[model samples]
Target: MRVVSLVPSLTEAVAVTAPGLLVAATDWCSHPSDLDVVRVRGTKNPDVPAIVALAPDLVIANEEENREGDLAALRDAGLDVLVTEVRTLEQAFAELERVLVDGCGLARPGWLAEAEAAWRDVRAPSERRTAIVPVWRRPWMVLGRDTFAGDLLARLGVENAYAGHADRYPRIPLEELSAAGADLAVLPDEPYRFTVDDGPEAFPELPSALVSGRHLTWYGPSLAEAPAVLGAALRAARG
Candidate 1:
């Protein structure tokens, strides 16, 4: 079956599970770097006409990464679109299985089981650390309540400072975030690419954990390694 994926993580999941199944994917679908597929466009502003021209049997999208109108347009053009909602790790696994096994009619990849086992074995720290996770730098948008990243951190025994906030990704001033009295600042390398010299300086008083955004924020084969990878990074930052 010919598939066009808009979500990067979904694209990686499908592509890695069954090579050559994808006819087209967004430019942001960077995994399996040697992927030889037609580039539709970015997640937010995909080229509708270019995608329709591909004549894919299924178009995979994420409710969070993609716009509703874009999915509607694809449907209006008579293209079958599968939209996946992944708010937590469980949701990510379930939605991935639905998209790959049920929707695409492919055999469940062995890696999926490994990923489940990895997460299942993770034990949250006895004493949790309050973390201020910044996804973006300019205007400073942070991970708030009910985010997948927040859930991942929670599993690692790191509670988000703004988890009680109403907005999922809220923009707050740096001073306000520092004043929130977080024990550590969990910084990822995407959306803003926070590094040792960059994000650490903002919070001199708190420890900074520089983590892989793909592993922390992305839900895919990376989930299998995220538990180990994220735990080490968070621990190292504390020391």
Candidate 2:
């Protein structure tokens, strides 16, 4: 079955589960680094005509990552589109199953089960610390309200300070973020590549956890090791 994946996390899931199923994927689908699929540009600005021309049996997308107009355009051209919405860890697992087993018609991948098992084994810390999780800078956008990354961090015992904010990804002033009363800064290296010299300096008062964006954001095989990987990073940063 030829499939086109617009979401990077889903791309990795499909690539790792059923190697030859993907005919095209977004330029941002970086995992499985040797992935040699047709690059369909970015998630927001995919080449719709090119994707349609490929004549894929199914095109996988995410509600948050992909544009609705693009999905509608593909459907208008008589292509089947499967759009996923992942807000929590459970939602991620369910959506992955939907994309792989239900949409791609493949057997349930072992990694999916392992990822679930791994998360289930996670034990929350006795004392949870609040954090200001920043996704971007310049304008300063942060994780707020319902978010996959926030849920993941919450599971890891680092609560998002702006989790009660109305906006999912709210743009707050740098001064406000620094004064958000968070114990630490959880910075991921994607959407905005936050580095040691780049992101940490912004919040001098808070401990900065330079975590892998893949482990913190992407919901695929990386989920299997995310708890361990992220837990270690948080520990190192806090200690």
Candidate 3:
């Protein structure tokens, strides 16, 4: 079955589960680092004509990562599109199953089960900390209510300070974020590459947990290692 994945996590999922199934993927689909496929540009602005020309049996995307108009254009060109919505870890698992087993017509992958088992025993730390999680810097967008990353952090004993905001990813002012009464700042390395020098300095007052964006945000094979990887970062930052 020929498939084209627009979401990076889904691209890795499909590539890892069923190799050679993907005829094309977005430029941002960087996992399985050796992935060799037709690059269809970035997730938000994929080359629609290029994707259509590939003649994939199915095109995969996420409701948040991909644009509606792009998906519609593919569907209009007589291609089957599977759009996924992942707001929490559970949704991630279910959606992964939907994409691989149901959508790609492949048997459930063993890695999916291993990923599930990894998070099965994760219990929140007794003393939870509130954090201001930033996804971007110039406009200062943050994790607001009902986000997959926020849910993952909560499971790991960090609560998002802006979880009550109406917007899923609210663009707050830098000054306001610094004053948000959060115990720390949880910075991921993607959507914006937050590094030791770049991000922590912004929140000078709060301890900065520079975490991997893949483990914190991407829901695929990395889920198996996210807990341990993220937990150590948070611990080191807190100490």
Q: Identify the leading candidate in terms of lDDT.
A: 3
> Model 2 scores what on Cα lDDT?
0.93
Per-residue lDDT, model 3, residue 55, is: 96
The clash count for each model shown is: 0, 0, 0
What residue runs in model 2 are displaced by over 4 Å at the alpha carbon? none
User: What does the lDDT read for residue 10 in candidate 2?
Assistant: 93
Superposed Cα deviation of residue 61, candidate 3 (Å): 0.3
In model 1, residue pairs whose N, Cα or C atoms come closer than 3 Å (at least 3 residues apart or on different chains), thus clashing, are: none
Report every candidate's CA lDDT.
0.92, 0.93, 0.94
Tens-digit lDDT string for candidate 3 (1-239) = 89999999999999998888989999999989999999999999999999999999999999999999999999999999999999999999999999999999999999999999989978778999999999998889999999999999999999999999999999999999988999889999998998898655788888899999999999999999999999999998873
| Prediction 1 TM-score vs. true | 0.98
Model 3 TM-score, all chains together:
0.98
Query: What tens-digit string does per-residue lDDT give for candidate 1 at 1-239?
Result: 89999999989898899977999988888898999999988999999999999899999999889999999999999999999988899999999899999989999999999999999999998989999999998889999888999999999999999999999999999999989988999999986899998655899888899999999988888899999999999999873
- Clash list (residue pairs), candidate 3: none
Better-scoring candidate (lDDT), 1 or 2: 2
TM-score per candidate, chains pooled: 0.98, 0.98, 0.98
